[model samples]
Target chain A: MKAVYKRELNSYLNNPMGYVFLGIFVLFFSVIFCYINLYSLVSSNISYTFSYMIYAMLVLMPLLTMRLMSEEKAQKTDQLLLTAPVKASSIILGKFFAAMTLVLLALVFTLPHIVILVIQGNPGFLVTLLAYIGFILYSSVYVSIGIFISSLTENQVISAVLTFAIFMGLLALEILFVPGIQSPTLYKILSGISFASRYSDFSMGVFNLTSLVYYASAAFLFLFFTVRVTEKRRWA
Target chain B: MIEISNLTKSFGKHKVLDNITFRVGEGEVLGFLGANGAGKSTTMNIITGYLSSNEGKVLINGINILEEPEKAKKLIGYLPEQPPLYLNMTVSEYLDFVYQLKGIKLNEKAEKGEKSEKQQHIEEICEMCGITGVYKRLIGNLSKGYRQRVGLAQALIGNPEVLILDEPTVGLDPVQIIEIRNLIRELGKKHTVILSSHILSEVSAICEKVIIIHNGRIAAASVTDKLIKEFQDSNRLRLTAEGDAQELVKTVSVIYGVDSVEIDETKTNSSAAEIIIRTSKDVRGPIMSRLVEKNIGVINFGLDTVSLEDIFLKYVGGESDEGSIQERAE
Candidate 1:
């Protein structure tokens, strides 16, 4: 697991991928941070930054996870991993955490926003901390979804596009439930399943255990599916 | 040691491996000979735990590969037809990754002795595979031969008891092919190696035991030389003499115990003619006297054995849609 993790992490860092992801993420994050906090002078609430970061992740996380499994399959390097002594689940988790680490690294680069908020204005530390936790958990669900999509195909472009499409649907789930589709029960059930809905509690300064469980279970569910897909592909 | 028993596999309706059974003992070099799409790669994949068979089991040293994959996989190293490599990584990094993937603790090995045993083992493998010079370079920049060496090095990293190399010399030039063949020969001294190739001479040169697969079934399996002798052509003798080609052919055609006679165009020219006599008996003395009595100047003569190419073509039946003997006749 460590071998896979280190190799995957190095692949991101050793190439332009890590830098490109970080650069684009920080640029977008700063633009949003400046427009919301500096320009609007709404420095009291930092949750807006966390909420926008989730949107940023809907695009960027796919980029990080798209090539994770698909590239390995295309290059036939999956043979090495599949035949290695490690369990298939461990390989999946190792790659999962490697992509998560990049997300964390990109988040780390956005740490200056917190510093600037702390220095320049009245910042809500507790809310900011909770929102950061919320952002990690929320982004993990998408990251897992991305990794799962990557495992479904050997084409990286297809993986990326499918992940983006699924994430767009999930991000728009709340709006999807807005109109009258004549199914209230279905709306309530789907709204409950909406990952974006569960995340709203965290950014609103409420640490609901149900929301936490929802996001955690969503991440676990996707990761479980990813492992199953990979295992099934070996037979295939 | 590896044993595959009644192994069967299929991709949906297309059966890839059909009730194949074979075994390789410790320190035995087994060669798998097959044409393209003959289930060679599929069988190797199943043995190495890369793919699961539909209705069979592969055992490595008596440990079932599917049931105890990690334990069995630890005992084997595999190199697929294409060398699986991360082009972005340097050779040292990729090898280190593979070494760790094999579950060898480098720190523990380092703690065991003065210097790092992990590094030492990797260096030794590099030296053996002749890739020491390219250890620091990225795999993408290296030539195909070096990439192949890196793949070989990856397989050699854990020093697994068995090595499964699928068409190890498929795309290499003649010189590179010979080099990899020598390396496999050297590796066979300590490891139980199973390699697949379409080239018959390669198998005859390096493998002690050869198994030929045709259309998802084992067409033949035996000692390499024994297989050669079993399907070998009829014995023949060739005599070069300074005589008329037609006269030489007609003279040898009437000899008793001689099956047939034909002028050896390869050896015949204006100054001399060569006639090959197919026979099951030793008529060398009679033939020599007959040539001398005819006043024909004899240059050289010798008996020829069947080449492995003939045996392979006979067994594989070439690409012709006919019986093996009919194909051989063609």
Candidate 2:
């Protein structure tokens, strides 16, 4: 697992994709940060910056995870991993953590905004920490879904497009279904399962345990599916 | 060092391997001879634990591959038809990654040596595979031969007891083919080797034992020389002479000990005719004397040695009739 992790991380660091991802992430983040805090002067809460960043993540996270498994399959390098004396779960987790590490590094680049806020105006430390945690958890779910889609096909473009489509669907579930459902009970269920509604609590400075478990379990379920997909390919 | 029993595999409704069984002893070089899509790679994949068999088990050095893949896989190394290489990585980095991925560990006592044991081990493998000069270069920049050598180097890491190579010399030039064949021969002295190829001379040159697979079945299996000898029992003689083609066949068919006589259409023309005679005994002197009496000048005459190509065709091109083939083998 450690060997796979190191190789995957180095693959990202050696290529231009890692820097490209960081560049786009920081670029959009700065734009959002400026408009939310500097232009409007709406509030001193940093969580507002994170809330808007989730929309940017819908397009950016796929860049990091699209080639994670699909490239291995397209290049026939998966034979090396599958034939090695390692478990399938270990290979999946190794790639998952590597992408997550890059996302965390991108999140670290946002710390300067918090510092600038502290210098000029008062900001709540606990609220900022909770918001960062919420972003990390949300990104984990996105990364897992991206990787799971990657394992399904060998074409990186298809993997990226499908992942982006799924993220968009998950984010707009309530809005897409609001007009179709007439019953109040069915409407409640649709909004309840929506990722946007669950994430709204975190952006509002509320540490909701149910939302935490929902995100963690959603991430775990996709990772488990990735493992099963790799194992099933052997039989195929 | 390896045993496979009653292996069967199917892709959807089409069966690829059917009740195949074979074994390789310690330090033996076995060759799998088959045409394209004859299930050669499938068998190798199953032995290396890369693919699962529907109704069979592979045991590598007494460890079941399906039941204990980690332990069984640790004892064997596999090189697929396409070498699984990361083009973005340098040769040294790729080897180091494979070394760690295989979970090879040096002795605790060797940890206190002058240089790190892992580095020394990888360097030694590179030297053996003749890739030391390109160690720092990226795999993408290397030539095809160098890429193949790097692939071979990765398979040699940890010095596994058994090596399974699927067409190791495919797409190489003649010189490179010979070089890789010599390398496999050298490695076979220390490890049990199983290699697959559709090239007849390659199996006859390197492998001690050969198994010919045709249409997902074991067509024949025996020691290489013994298999060739078994099919070469009936002697064939090629006689080239300046005579009428029809009259030559008529005269040769009546000779004693000659089972049949056929005009070699490819080498025969109006002036000189080449006749192939299948005989159970030496009739060279009788044929020359008879032809001299008929005023026909003998241009060339020699015994034609039956090559592995003939045997391969006899087994693969014939009908799917195992009973006749078995009787001929006996």
Q: What is the interface RMSD of each candidate, in Å?
A: 0.8, 0.7
- Candidate 2 on A1-236: residue-level lDDT in tens? 88898999999899999999999999999999999987786666888888889999999988999999999999888988988988889999999999999999999999999898898888888888888899999999999999999999999999999999999987776557664798999888887777777777888889999999999999999999999999898798
Relative to the real complex, the DockQ score for model 2 comes to 0.73
lDDT, candidate 1, B1-330, per-residue tens: 798999999887677789999999999999998877778999998998888998878999999998999999998889998899999999999998899889975554465447677788999999988889999999999999889889989998879999999989876789889989999999999999999998889999999999999878998899998887775544678788887899888877777878888887887888899887888788887887887887888888877667767776776776643543343344
Clashing pairs in model 2, backbone N/Cα/C closer than 3 A? none
Per-residue lDDT tens digits of candidate 2, residues B24-132?
9999999999877788999998998889999988999989998898999899888988899999999989998998899899752445546677778888888888898
True contacts kept of each: 0.90, 0.72
After superposition, which runs of candidate 1 have C-alpha atoms over 4 Å from their true positions?
Answer: A178-183, B106-114, B239-243, B254-256, B262-275, B297-300, B320-330
lDDT of 1 at B325: 31
- Candidate 2 positional error at A201, Å: 3.0
